[model samples]
Target: MDGKTLVRRTNFTRIIAACAFIFATAASAGPTVKTLRVDVLYWSMNIPGQVAMRKGLEQEAAAINRDADKKNQPRIELTPYIAGDGSAGIERQIAQMFEAVKRKPDIIIVQPTDNAALAAPLRAANQAGIPVVAYDQYISGGTLAAFVTSDNYQAGYLDGEYLAAHFPDSKELKLILVEYPHVSSTVERANGLLDALRDYRQPFRILKTYEAVEPNSGARAGAQMLRDFPATGSVDAVFSVNDGGGLNIVEALANAGRTEIVVASIDGDPKSVDNIRAKRLTHIDAAQFCGPLGAEAMKIAYALATGKKVAPHHLVPVFPITSETLQLYPGWGGPIPPRFAKPWQARVPYWEGTVRPAK
Candidate 1:
């Protein structure tokens, strides 16, 4: 061959050999995992369930990143947006979803504030091919890759069942629901509570439904509840959806020097458990496996991001923490206690259970 032609051939051979060496090195290093970008649209962190879910998600993410270096696992980049507190938060959540869609994240994980309000933005996210994984509360109008949440109905059922067993069947038990109806989780809670009362054939009448699910609103509702039922024995029981605002009601009743009302609530908040232990107004508190609920949500999101098939819905079990079952719970970041009670007849499926909480 001529000198210039021979030089060109030599360089081409070297290029092929270098590519082979690179491939061999990569093969020895094991499989490559693609990192995913996830945006989190969280409702108010004021609620204890959201706080625990956040903690659990962070812990699980850290674990995944730590393991990524050693195992064939993907790492995730998380961007968070928090909606402000109370009913005002519902608007903020709706706006945040549209903004999240603009950013074009690999996955959008959300705790929806209002089921119907989110339909527009969530539907937009769907059209864009950005998968979403929702937790705690559901989004109404989208094809969610996965949805993970505690068995909200079961929590309310536990509260209602507890009240049914204790209250006198002779008179209709005066009932109050410290409720917010926009979100599916709380709505299910109220439904479950009422279902339990009916299932047990307990006589009861709903005195009122005070709109409150956070601290400030709860405080107002609590004080108002007392005004409406001035006498000590006027209100038989109160069932607050979650402890975020429910604790405010508890404190309000306590501060007013009232003791006649028997209060039951959903959520496994530390303070709620404390109230139960102290023999206070919040007699029974049904608790969520909050930390684990968050962690499992992360796992589901990760699976979807990595192009793995995940179950569309996963429901974690909730525990009822009374004075007796308090010992079974080890707090939020937990060695989640085994399923404690017999099966509950709920509207939701029997697949209610949780994974280990991220420590």
Candidate 2:
């Protein structure tokens, strides 16, 4: 071969070798397998939030796991810490987050009781660059990567509307509100009911408000209220923040032999459905409270862990489960009203009973 030709061929070979070398390096450096750890802090094992987490979130996490596995990507490890009571749960969760910050968990799922408790730790996590998703309750003035919950105010307003429709012609109505002390969802629901009822010009009075720590406690408190109030007149309605409280109120009324009062509560658990069936509780406005919120929060957690962008807030919608509809869908909560959209309507199947197939 001529020297000139040899030199040209040598240059071409070098270029080809360099290109091959670059390609090999790029292929070797495929997407890094990220190790994600998620910590879920919840109020109790039996509540709707925890129920959702237990039933729905596992499915979402499993889907994420499947996707990651297909791409030969890092797996996500989810760890849940249940605090059992509202106040204690919040404190324990805060402590867990502080410990997690040190351990550097990729994601933390938190349900704070109120704005103040939520802000501090969330801010600290944000400053440390750990992404946090707040669910079941809203946390104000904090850099939460995402927030997922039902429109609590709307749930409460619907409770009021149900009561209004149930007792349109009633005058001199006496009402009782059974509540939990420091739960953000409960507080929001209570406020919504009171605010909606405030506009009524009828002779309605909030006869009493009782705070109960446990579900049955609300019922006991409600019974006490019933016995104490009607000595002079009658209680037209009892509004409970949740089904547990509402069911308790119904039990209280039944025990007191004052079954005439209309009982309405949130959550469409089987017990509440049974109450509606037996003509004990009049109305139930159940949100996709547990499963969807739990599942979506985990989705947000996975996104944050993988450094993906997510919406700042996600509102899970709720609907009313009345007596008429309950009769149609026996053995579970009634069908979602036709006016609602997807996902919200999809939740009707999940909350048919107290025990559902795990997600």
Candidate 3:
């Protein structure tokens, strides 16, 4: 070959090699690594939020792990600390969060006992540059990095509206409000229902209100209420703040041969949906977005860990489900919508699944 041709070929090969090297370097230089720790404070793993986390809907940790695999980000490790139930247990959760703060977790997930219990610790965490994200129930008026939850008050108001619509002609409406102690969600819901009912202006009497120590305690409370007010005639409606509690009320009413009483509650779980199908339960203020709530919680945690700005609160919407519409879709009891079938998709599937049946 001629010397000039050889030189030109060598230059071309060198240029190709340099380009490949630059491309390789750029590919290797991916996103930065960020280490974040998350703690989940909740009553039971069996509930919807915990269940979503367990089922992997939040995907914060998973997203971090994926980014790590792609050489783009750091690994996020989540540690869950479960508090059994009620005010005392939630107090213990606050103690655990204080201890976690010392370890310096980038973010912590809390279900506050009330508006006050976790205020100090959260403030301390914020002052120390750690972000706090609360879920299910929020600790209001604090430096909470983000509050992820459904519109609980609206859910309760919807329940009240449903009851009012169902019993429009009643002159004197007798009802029982069943709730659980230290459950901020329940408290807000019950209060919202009472607030909505105030517009009725009828001779409605709240015969009594009862507190259930556990979710299942609603049955006992309902039965006792029935026995106590049997002579006063039948209850027009029973408003339970949660599905489990509502189911308990239904069971109690059934056992007492008072199936005619309308039952309503929030959270459309499998049993509650079944009860609706069977005509035992009348209404449910459904918050089928627990998965999204978990996802939002993790997203806020990730943002805080990475030193990104996040909102102080996030209010997810809630919907009402009645006996007329509860079973249009499958796996309202299981995770993932019916469309995905084998594996779960993203928020689209969740919204579609929850809304399709209702529509």
Which candidate leads in TM-score?
A: 1
Q: Across residues 1-359, which tens digit of lDDT does each residue of candidate 3 receive?
A: 99999999999999999999988997787544556666666546535544654444346568767876786566777777766556666778778878878878767777665666777788778778877887777675558777776677767876766566556645677887787646567787888787766754435688788876345576678778777777535677778777655667677777777766777777766677677777764555454456655666777677777778866666655555655444433332334334322111211223223321111
C-alpha lDDT of residue 314 in model 2 = 74
Off by over 4 Å in 3: 1-32, 46-50, 53-60, 140-142, 181-183, 200-203, 328-359
> What is the C-alpha lDDT profile of model 1 across 157-252, one tens digit per residue?
888888887877677998988888888899999999999889888999898889888888888998898899888878889999988889999999
Whole-model Cα lDDT of every candidate shown, in order: 0.84, 0.67, 0.65
Alpha carbon lDDT at 132, candidate 3: 80
- Ordering by lDDT: 1, 2, 3
Best by lDDT: 1
The C-alpha TM-scores of every prediction are: 0.88, 0.78, 0.77
Supply the TM-score for candidate 2: 0.78
Give the TM-score comparing model 1 with the true structure, all chains together. 0.88
Q: Which regions of candidate 2 deviate over 4 angstroms? A: 1-29, 198-203, 230-233, 327-359
lDDT of 2: 0.67
